[model samples]
Target: MDVNGFQVLPSQVESVRLIFKRHPDIAVEFRAKNQHLRNACMDFLLSLIETMCQSLEDLSNEDLVEADIALTYLKDAGFKVDWLEKKLDIVKDKKEKEQSSLARLQEMEDSLLKLKQHCSDLDALVEKEHEELSDTRTPMSFDDVV
Candidate 1:
């Protein structure tokens, strides 16, 4: 089977099927590993679209006329350009949100580290004061009271 531009051999597909049959939870594992695979596929599709757009921009008038005719046919076949655009926009928004969440997590980690250091410093100061107090001793005699 051809997935995007990559060919999936029948043997490989069979192997995956066997694994899934043996362990249904493999679906979750596969999904975890497929996150990057999905991202790569999306990136490939985006770049292909960008290259196509650039070529369209540089097309001759005759080619533009032909492209328009082809586009109309594609639209008639239920491939709307606006729908593709909206899908891309959704992916872009998801990427932005992921990045923003990562940045906030990093900020929280930094703050936690600083707070930890402050706690350590306070502990050390308290320990030093305890040691100094222990070192200083005073002896009292009955003569002093008299």
Candidate 2:
């Protein structure tokens, strides 16, 4: 079947859909926060396919040339897709690293707070002991049977 400027075999659309479904998370990441771009790309591709299908009845030499042009356009779009995918992968990795670092920092903060509290408690205990020892060490009575 003709799709856009490229030929769509029976398996082509299905294959594309399957690939996207298989990597749904990646697809979502690539389309992240930009429904407009995603929608535009999908619509453009679909329309190109529809035009190709409609032109199939008039498959003359000129039509063939047009199809070649369309195919080139589609190929360029594929390159863009590849670039977007790579960028998404990098973004995901960066986010994961940031999250990991944040978690470590939070853990360190909690540990530091606990250690500070423990030190404060120890200091209070030591001060109490010193006071107790001072109380027990009564000065020798000056008037005691000298």
Report the C-alpha lDDT of model 2 over 21-90, residue by residue, as the tens digit: 5544323423223555444555554554444444323434454455456545544544234433343345
- Give model 1's clash tally: 0
Model 1, residue pairs in steric clash:
none
RMSD of each: 16.2, 18.0
- Please give the lDDT score for candidate 1: 0.50
Local error of candidate 1 at residue 102 (angstroms): 1.3
Best by TM-score: 2
* TM-score, structure 1 vs. true: 0.41
Q: Which stretches of candidate 2 lie over 4 Å from their true place?
A: 1-39, 42-79, 140-146
Residue-wise C-alpha lDDT for candidate 1, range 1-146, written one tens digit per residue: 54332234564445435433554442232232354564343333334344335432353445434544544443443333444445444544555666689799999999999999999999999999898887665455699678
| TM-score to true structure, per model | 0.41, 0.44
